[model samples]
Target: MVANQNSVVVVMIPLPLQGHLNQLLHLSRIISAHNVPVHFVCTTAHGRQVRLRLQGWNPNAVSTIFFHDLPIPPFACPPPNPNSTNKFPSHLQPLCEAATHLRDPVTSLLRKLSPTTKRLVIIHDSLMSTVVQDFISLPNAESYTFHSVSAFSTALYTSKKVGEQIRELIESKGVTEYDLSFDGCFTSDFKEFMSVQHEYAKLSSGRIYNTCRVIERPILELLETDARSRNKLLWALGPFNPLELKRKDDGPIQRCLNWLDKQASNSVIFVSFGTTTSFSLEQITEIAIGLEKSDQKFVWVVREADKGDVFNGNIIHVELPKGFEERVKDQGFVLREWAPQLDILVHPAVCGFMSHCGWNSCVESMSMGVPIAAWPMHSDQPNNAFLVTNILKIGILVKDWCRREEVVMSAAVENAVRTLMGTNEGEEMRERAVSLGQEIRKYVLGNGVTQTEVGSFIAHITR
Candidate 1:
C-alpha cells in the first residue's frame, strides 16, 4: 500500500493552545522528516507566534512545513450579569468563536488543495472536531482527531462507566478515591464544551493520542477492549516533544542556568504551571509561604493574570508575604516572565517539579526523569494528576480538583513539597522517574515505538 510520498500532504489543524500546538508541530516535524509535506493550519495570532519561535529552528528541516492562517472571527457573548453564577461562558467564548469561524476557511483551504493533491489527510485537534465533518465532505480528504491529553484521560472520557464514576466523584463531597470500574482516573459550561468534543470524536476516521503504550498500557488496553471505542483505530504515538531543540542561553535562560550551576545535584524544585494556568492572589500567597516554609532551593515561574478573564480571573498584582523575597533571597528565584522550562527540567539542580500536571509538562518532566508535585488546575489536569500520583507513582499530589474551589493552605503545600523533595518515598519516586525517562528516550529514537507509529500513520494516509 505504499503510495508516492511526494504526492501526499498532511493538513495539521491544532487547537489554539500552546500545548496542543507544540505537540502537533513536533508530530509535523516527524512527518516532514519522512519527506512528506505538511500544511499547518492556525489562527493569525498563533501563526505569528509559531513563526517567531521557529526562528531558532533548523531552516532546512522545517522548510516543508507551510503555515495557513485562518483569521479569528469577531463574535461576542453578552457579559455575565452581576448575579449570574456562570463564569465558564466568558472563558469558553473565544475558543467557541474560533471553532465556529475557522471551519469555513479550513474547508476552503482543503478544497483548493484537493484537485492537485494525490491524497489529503486532515489531522485536527479533538476539540476542533467541528472542522472534521467539513474536511471529510471534501473529495479525497480524510480526517483524524488528535488528543493532546494522556491515553488515560481519553479512556476516562470515552468510557461510559468511567464517566459515571467521575460524575459521582464530583457530586460527592469528601470523596478521595476515584474507584472506577477499571481503576484510572469539570463544570457545566466546561461540561458543555467537553460534550461537543465527545460528539465530534465519534465522527472522525480514527484517533491519535500523545501518549506511549508502555506508559499507559492499562488504559489504552481498556480503550481497545471497550465496545464503543473498539471500532476506531487508536494510535499511541508520543512523547511527541521537542527534545532536540536547544534553548539559546540569553536573558532569563542564561540567568536560570547560571543559578542552577551553583546548586547541588537534584536539590532544587522547578515550579511552574503551563501557559494558560493562572492563580488567585490568595493561592499565590499560600504557595509563596509554602515554598518559604519548605526551606528548599527553588526556581518558580509566575505570570500576571488578567482580572477580566473568566477562567483564571486572578488579580494582576501578586503580593507575596512581606519581606518574603528578602527572607529567601539566597534560596529562591521567582521568574516574572517565561523561563526555559525544558532546559530547567534537564538541569542537574532540579530534583522535582511543582506543576499543574498538564500533559505536555507531565510528559516532559517524566521524559526528563524529574518527579512532579501534582497541583492540577483545570481540564484534563486532574486526571493527569491522578495518573502521576496513583498509577505512575512518579509524583505526589499537592492538590486535587475536588478541593479546587477551596484555597489550599500553606501547611498543605509545605507538606506536599517536603514529601516530594525530602522524604524516603520521594527518593523511590525519583529513582522510578529516572528509569522511566530513560525508557521514554529509547522508545522515541530511531525505529522505536513512536517512529513506527508515525510510519504506520504515514502509510495509512498514503494508501
Candidate 2:
C-alpha cells in the first residue's frame, strides 16, 4: 500500500461552486506560500474547470500545488428555475442528498492518505459541513470553517427582532417551513441550533471570516467570546491575494482595468449580481434609469441568456439598461457583461459596489474598503445585505425591497447610487472602508496557516 509520505499539511477543499472554489483557492495559496504542501480536493468536472482556468503555476515558492480530483457524480442541486423568481424549484431538494453522498468520498479520500501523522485542513463549502458527520474520527486533522462572507453577515443571519415579529404575523406562503428570513428568526427555540453551531465552531479549531476588522467588529467580538469559551481560534483574514493572485491566470479575464483608467478615481459605481443570480428584465430597467438619474459613472456586469426562456425576465446577470450603455459610453457610465471583479474593486477609480450580496462578493468588496449599495437576491443574500447596511455602517441601503422582492425603480436606484458615489458621509464611509481593508491585509499576510496563530490552531485539533 502507498503510505501517505508527504509531511506538509494537506487541506481537502470541497469546492462545489464558483464562490466555494475561489475561497478555498485563496486560502490554499496562502498556506502553500508558507511551505505547506497543499492539495485542492476538487471533483473531476470541477478539476477540469480549474485546469482550464488556471494556466498552472506553483501556488507558492516551495510547495507544489496540484488538483486532486475525486470521481464523484455531479451534485444534484436544482438548476435555477427558468420559470419564475417567486419560488424555489423542487430540483433544489436534492442538495441535502448530494451533501450526504459527498461525506463518503471525503472520508474515503482521507483514509486513502496513509500519512497518519500529517494534519488535514478541509477548506470546503460551509454547506458541505452538513455531511462531514465526523471530524475527530479522521487521522490527524483540524478543520477551519471559513465563511466567504463577512462576520457582520453571520450576525445578520438572524433578523433584528422586529423583522421576525412581522413574519410571524404575515404567514407568507413559504414562511412556515423555513427558518427566519432577514426580517427575523430569534427564539429561545434555537437553543439546540445555537449549541450545535457553537460546537462545530469549537471543533473547527479555528473560525475564519473573509472580512476586515472595521465592518466585522461586532460579529468578531461575539465570535471571540464564543471561541474563547470553546478555546478556538478566530481569524479575520481577507482580501487575500487579489493583486498577486495566481495558479489560475488562464481564465478569460475581462479587460476592466482599461475602463477604470478613464474614469475618475473613487467616482465609479460597480454593480454585479455575482456569477449566479440573474435579474428580471423589469429589475434591469429600473436600475438603468436609476444610474442615469444619479449621473454616476458605473459598470454593471450582465450575463448572456441561457435557454430560450427568460431566467429573470429574459435578462441574465450580464444584461444592461437599453441604450444607456451607448449613451454613457463616453463617461464610462455603463456596464459590462462580466468584469474581473477583484481587479476592478481594488482599482483606485472604482468607488462603491452595487451588489447582490453574495458572500464572496460581499467580503471582497468590504475588504477593498469600498462601500456597498446592497441588492440582495435570495437565500443568504438578504442576510448579507443586512450586515452591509446595519452592522458595517459603511453601506447606505437602497430602499428597493417591495413585498419581499427587489423593486429597484430608477429613482430609488439613482438615490442609492449617488449617495454611495460621493458625499461627506460617502467619503467618510470610503475612508472607513480603506482603514478596514488595511486590517484585513495585515492578518492574511501577517501569519497565515504557518505561524503560531494557525499552528496553534492546527495543534488544538491534532491533540
Candidate 3:
C-alpha cells in the first residue's frame, strides 16, 4: 500500500459537497484497483464524512489509496432554503469560500510529493481547480479536471455560441424549447463562481468525465470537438460506483432492503432527493399527503437539512406531518436514515424513482433500469432531467424548472407518482430503461467502450 519514492502517484481533490466527494472517492477506488497509488485530499471533516458514508467499498481497507485530510478555516454552513425563489443551493457559498484556503496546504503537498514521486498526477473536481492552480509550476506534475456532472450538462457550459448550438442540438433530437428551462437556477454570484471554474479547467492537462459514449455519444462527441479543436485532452471513463451488494449489517438501510423483499415485482416507488436539497416544512407535509393519496406502496427517505456543519454534534431534526408515520405504517415506509440508493434501485420491487435528477442519481437510476419522475432542484439537475425526459425518453418530468419556486401541491405530486408507477406509459419507459441499463452494464465489462476508456486513461497516466 505504501508508495515507493519512484512510483507515480495520483492526488485527488474534490469539491466538499456530498455528490462531488462521492464521485472522486469512487474514482479513487477505480484508479487504485489498477495498482496506482492515489492520495485523496480534502478537508478533515469532509474526509471523515466521505469515508463514513461511502457504500460499495471500505475506505479504511483500501491501502493503495491514502487520505490526506487537510484543515480549512471555519465558515458558516447555513441550511438550504427550499422556499427561496432562487433554485440554487446558494447557502453553500460559504463552504466554497472556505475551500479557497486549501490553496496553501495543497501547494505544499504537491511540492513535497514532487521530488519523491516519478510524477504527481492530480485529478481534481473542476470547481476545485483554483485550489490546485499552482500545479502548473511543477515540471513533474500534471493535472486533469474531473467533471462530476454528465457530458450533456457540461456541453451547455463549454460549447461556444451556447444558445444557438444548444438549440440546434435539442431540436435535432425533437425537443421543444419550452421543455427545458433554467429560469432561476443560478444567481449572479454563483454564475461568476461557475464561470471561474470553467475557465480554470482550460489550464488543466485534460478533461475527464464520469460518462461513457454509450450514454452520451452526441454530447461526448461535442466535447471532443472542443477538446480536440483546442488540442486539449479528454476522456469519458465512467459509470462509477459499479458495485451493487447490499450491506450486511442490521441497520436502517438493510432494513429498508428487507422490506422490499415482500413487495410484488415493480410495485414500489422510491422517493429521495440528494443531500444538498432541503424542503420547507410545509412542502414536506405536502409530499407526505401526496404519497399517501397516491394509493401506492412507497419508501421515502427523508433527512434533516444540513446546518453549515453536519459534524458539529448538534441534533438534527426534520418534522413531518403529525402522525404521518403511523398513518402510512401499513402502506409506506419512511426511512429517516441514510438509504443505500443503488441497493434500493436494483431491487425487483422498486420500479420508479421520484428524484431531484442530480447526475449521480440520474446515472444510478438509468444503470439500474429504474424509471424516474424528475423534479430537478438546481445546478445541472434541470439539464440532466431534460436529458432523461426529453432526449433519452427514459423518465418523466415531475415538475418543470420554471415552477420550482412554487410549492408543488400534493395533487401534483400524487399525479406524478401515479403516472410514473401505475400507467402503461411508465411501463414502456421502464422497458427502455432496462435495455439502456443492459447496454451500460455491457460497456463497463470486458472489451466494452467504458472499460476501454478506463484502460486508455490508466495507460496514459502510468506510461
Candidate 4:
C-alpha cells in the first residue's frame, strides 16, 4: 500500500497533547484511505502514546500511514496547579518550548522524503508550525495549517475587542509581543508560544478546520469573510473520529458499559472534565456533595490533571471525600482513570454531560445528542461554553466566567445537574440536541458537506 514514486504524500505534524494529536491522527487515516501515503511525525515517546491509546481503527493495518519518531532533548515537566486562580493550564508551556528543538530533525526528514514524491504535503497543527517552517521552502513541499479548535472560538478569539482585552491582560502580567489571544487563559510564555505559531501560519498554502458547515455555518461563514482568511483554500472536514466504529473493551471498561445497560433510558448523567482540568480537594468534595444531593444516576471520571509531559511516569494522588464514595455507591459510579468517553456518551442511558467544555469533548457530546452542563475551565472553554449555552441552545451554563476563580458551591452544581437532567427545559434542550446531531450526521456520515470537502482536499493534493 505504499505510494508510487510519483504519488503525492502527506506528512502530519501534530502538537503532542492528547486532543491535538487525536485530530491529526484521524485526518491521517482519512487521507490514507484515499491511497495517499501519510507519515505521522512526533517524538519517540508521543509516538508510542499514540499507538497504545488510539481507540477505533488499527494503525498497524493502515499500510499507507507510517510513523516517523524524532528525538528531542529532555525538558522540565511540571504538574498543573489544581488551585491556581488563573484558569489556564500554564504548566503545559514548557512542552511547547521543548517541541521547538525538533526543527533540525524534522527538516532533515522532510528533505529526505521530498525528492521521491510528486508532492509532499505537510499538514501541521497550527501551534506546531514552528517545527516545520524551515522545510516549507522545499520545491515540492506544500504546507497547510490545521486548526484543531472549533470555528466559533477561533472567530471570537480573532475579534478586535477580545484580542485587545487579552493583550492587555497578558501585558499586565509582563508579556509584551504575542499576536493571538485566549483571554486570561494563557501565561506570558504561552503567549510567546502562540506568537511564534501565528507568524509561521502565514506561510501555509491552505487552512484546515476540524469542523463542518451544519453546526457552525454562521461562524464558518464569518471566518471565510474575515480578511485574514480571505483567498486561502479553506476546508471543513471533520466530526473526525469514526462515528460508528465498533469498540471492544474488557475488564473495567466492560463493567462500566454493563452498568450503563442496566440503567433506565436517558436517566444517567456523565460527569468528566477533560485531562487538563484538575480541582482542589475542597472542590472535589463540593462536586461529590452536589451529585449526591441531586440524586441523579451518574458516572464520574476522577483523575488529576496532566503534567507538562503527559508521560512523565509520576502519578499525583487524587482522592474523593472519605466515606463519600460508599454513601453514593448505589446512586453513582466513580471511575478513577481514563474512561471510554465516547462509548459512554453514545449509550442510551446517559442523558447529559457535566463538562469543562473542552473543544473535543464538546464536539463528541454534540455528535451524540447529549445536552451539557457547561463548567468552563480555561483556554477556549469559556467561549465554548457560550457557544453551547447561548448559540447552540443545547446546554446550560454551570459556572459564570466572571466568577471562575471562586469555587463553585455544591448548591450551584446541584441546581445545574437537576436542571440539565430533570426539568422540562432539559427535555426541550435534549430534543434540539438530537435534531442538531441528526443534521450534523447528514453532513459527516452521508454523502454531504464533509465528503465533498474531503474529496476536494484529496483532489487538490493529487491534481
Candidate 5:
C-alpha cells in the first residue's frame, strides 16, 4: 500500500512472556485500524514461531498484517545458579539489551519502507524503560511505551514494588542485591515504575496504557489533570486482552469449549496464572486442594511448571485431595495444563474467576463481566487484588491474614470459591462485574469520550 497518510511504525520489543506479547499484539491491530501501514517487530526465533503459528492460523490469509524480523539472539548457557523462584527477578535487563540493539536496525528498516514513515511507536513494557530511553528522537519518530497494567494498579505497583527497589537502589544497592534476607524488604514496585514512567512520559511523544480510563477514573484523571502530565498520557485503548489458542490443535480445544458451553450458565470457576508466573510443585498442590474443598464446579487451567504434560502426573490425586476429581467429575470439573482462556472466560457458563490476579487477567476478567476470586501471587498482583476488592466493588478479595502473598490454604480457597459460586453473594458479584464490563467495553470499542481522545495524543505531542 502507498502512503496515503503519515506512516506510523510500531516497534514491539517482544518478550518470551505472554501478557506483554498480548499487549503488543493488541496495539498492532489498533495501529492497523488507524490506517497506518503498521509493521510488527519481534525476535528472529519468536518471529519465526509467530509466522509458523500464523500460517496455521490464516491458511487463507484472512488477516492483513506483517511482522518485521530482527537479528537473532545468540544462545547463552543457563544461569550459574538457577532458582525458579529468584530466577530473572530482573528480566527487564535483557529486554533493555534487546531494545538498545534492535532500535537502530528497526529505524533503518522502517525508513526504507516508505517516505511517509514519519514516526515509530515502541510498545516497550514498563520494566524495559532503559531500552526506550536510548531512542534518540520523539516528535518526528516517536515511541509509546505501553504499561500492561492499569494506571491505578501501576500506582499501587509503584507504591509497593517499584518504589521499594528505588529505595533499595538508593539506600543499599549492594545489600539489597546480595543479602537474601535483606533483599526481603517489601515496598512498592509501581512507584519506581512511575519514576521510569514519568521519565518516559517526558521523552516519548505520547504515553499509552493498556487500560480503559473508565475503570480507573481517578487515576486517569490524576494523570490528565496534572499540569506536568496532560495529553501525554493516553488510555481507553482497548480490552487489549489475550487467550491461549493453537491452530493445529484447535479441534481438541474447540471440543473442550463446546463441553463448557453445554454446562449451566455462570456455573464454572476459571483458574489460570498466565505464562510468565510459575507455581511451585507445593503451590499447585494447595490450589488443587483448595478448589476441591470449595465444593464448586470448576474449569481449572494450570500452565505446566516445567516442560511436560501434567495430566499424566498426580494432578488430580496428588495435587488435589484424594477422590476429589472423581466426586466432582460428574459436576464437570475440567482440568487442563493449559486452556483457551479468552474463549473460556467469554463463555456463558463461566460464573467466576480464580486467578493470580495478574494485571491482564484482572482486566480480562472484568471485561468479560466475570466476577473474580482474587488469589494474587507474586509481583503487582496484590495491588490488583486491592483494586478488584476495594476500588471496583466488582469482585471479592480472598486475603490471607496481613500476608497478601501467602500461599492461600485450602480453607480460604474453599470459602472464597464458595462465596463466588454460592447464591446471594455470587449473584451480586456477577451483577457488579457485568455493569463494569459494559463500561470497559467502550474503551475497547473506541466509543467512549476518553478513548476517542487518545487518537489525538499524537497531535498533542507534535503541537
Candidate 6:
C-alpha cells in the first residue's frame, strides 16, 4: 500500500500508554491500508517497545507507515520507586510535560517533510491535545483529536448542563453507586485532566472517536445537539481492534489455549484490568478470596503497583495472600505478567470477563461474545462500566463507585462473580453479548458504520 507523491500524510501522536498506543496504532493501520502515508510519533522508549511488540510484522507490506521517535523530557517529579506501597498518583502531568517538550522536535520533523508532496493531517490523542497546536500551526495542515473512550463519556465531559449537575452532586456528596454516569464517577485528578483536555480540544478542527454510532447513537445525537458540541465535527469510526487479526500461537498463548481445552463451555472467567490498573494489597486479597469462594475456574492477569511502568520486558512479582496460589491451584491460573488477552477471550471456555471497563477491554469482550463483570477502577472506566451494565445490559456491575482505597468486600465480589458465571441473569447477559458481538463484527468488518465513517474521515482530512 504505497502512497503516491501527492498523497495525504497523516501524523499520529499517541499518548504513551498501552491502550492509547494500541488504539492509535490500529487507526494508523486503517489509514495506511487506504494508501495514506502515516508518521507515528512517540518517545524513544515507547517507540522501541512498539517495534518489539510488532517485530513479526512485515513493514514492506505497509510501505507507507513510519515511526518517529522523540527523546523523553525530564519530569519535575521523579519516577515512582519500585518499593513504594502507594500507587503512582497520576501519569497526566508527566505526559503533558513531555508533550510540551516535544513541540520543538515534532515541529522540526514536520518542517523537514516535503510540503508540496505531503498534504499534512495531524491526529493526536485527546490527552496530548497540547501538542497538536504546534502541528496545526503549520501551513496547509489540519488537526483532529482522537478520543479512545466512548462517545457517552465525551458528551458528559463536554455538556455544560451535565457538567453543572455533576459538580453540584459532587460538592454535596462524593460519587455514589446510584449516580453511575460519567459526572458521578470521575476522580478529582481525572476531572482536572478532562477540564484541560476539553479546553485544548477547542483548538482542533474536529474530533474522531474509536466507537460505532450504532452502539452509542443516543449519546452521539446528544453531543451533536448540545450547544457546546453542536458546531464541532465528530466521527465515530470504530470498535477497531487489531487483535481480531489471526496469528499463530506462541508458547505461552498455546499453553493458555491448551488449558482452556479441558474446561467445560462457558465455565471459565477471564480477569484482567488492562496494563496500567493496579490494586492495593488488601484489594487483591479480597479479590483472591472472592475468586476462591466463588468456586469458578479463572485466569487472572496480575501486574505490579507501578502503573506507569510498561513494557519493562520482565515478569512482575506480585504478592498474593498467604498460600493463596496453592489454595486455588486446582481452580484458577494466575498470570503474574502479561497474557494473550484476545486469545483467552475468544476461547469457548471463557464465558465472562472481570474487567476495569476500559473501552478497549469492553469492545474486545463484547466483540468476542464474552459478558463482563464490570469492575471499574479509574478515569473513564466508571462511565464505561455504566455503558456496559446499564445501557447495553450485557454485563453486571462489580462495584458502584471509583474509590480505590475502599476495599470491596469478599462477599460483594463473590456475588458479582456468581451472577456473571452461574445465575440466570448471567445467562441472559451472555445471550445479549453474543448478539451484540455479531453486530459489532458486522459493522467493523463489512461496508458498515465504522467503515463508512473512516472513509468519510479520510475524505474530510484529505480535502
Error of 6 at 200 (Å): 3.0
Task: Find the candidate with the highest lDDT and give its number.
Answer: 3
Write the residue-wise lDDT of candidate 3 on 140-190 in tens digits.
899999999988877776665544566688888766565444567777888
Q: Give the backbone clash total of model 4.
A: 0
Model 5 C-alpha lDDT per residue in residues 301-364, reported as the tens digit of each score: 6554321211123432224446656876755455454455667788788889988777778878
Off-target runs (Cα >4 Å) in candidate 6 are 1-4, 51-61, 76-92, 114-118, 161-177, 180-194, 227-230, 305-316, 402-404
Between candidates 3 and 5, which one is better according to TM-score? 3
TM per candidate comes to 0.87, 0.76, 0.95, 0.92, 0.76, 0.87
Supply candidate 3's per-residue lDDT for 113.
Answer: 83
For lDDT, candidate 2 versus 4, the one ahead is 4
Model 1 residue 380 lDDT?
72
Model 4, position 452: C-alpha lDDT score: 86
- Candidate 1 residue runs with Cα over 4 Å from true position: 1-5, 50-61, 75-92, 161-176, 179-185, 227-230, 305-317
Candidate number that wins on TM-score, 2 or 6: 6
What is the descending TM-score order?
3, 4, 6, 1, 5, 2
Tens-digit lDDT track of model 2 for 167-239: 4433442335333344422223333333444445445666666654545554566667766766766776554
lDDT over C-alpha atoms for residue 341 of model 6: 73
Superposed model 2: Cα runs more than 4 Å off: 1-8, 50-63, 74-99, 134-136, 155-206, 212-215, 228-233, 239-254, 304-322, 333-338, 400-403, 442-463
Which stretches of model 4 miss by more than 4 angstroms? 1-3, 159-182, 227-230
Residue-level error in angstroms, candidate 3, position 316: 3.6
lDDT of 6 at 342: 74
The best candidate by TM-score is 3
- Give residue 208's lDDT in candidate 6 (0 to 100): 83
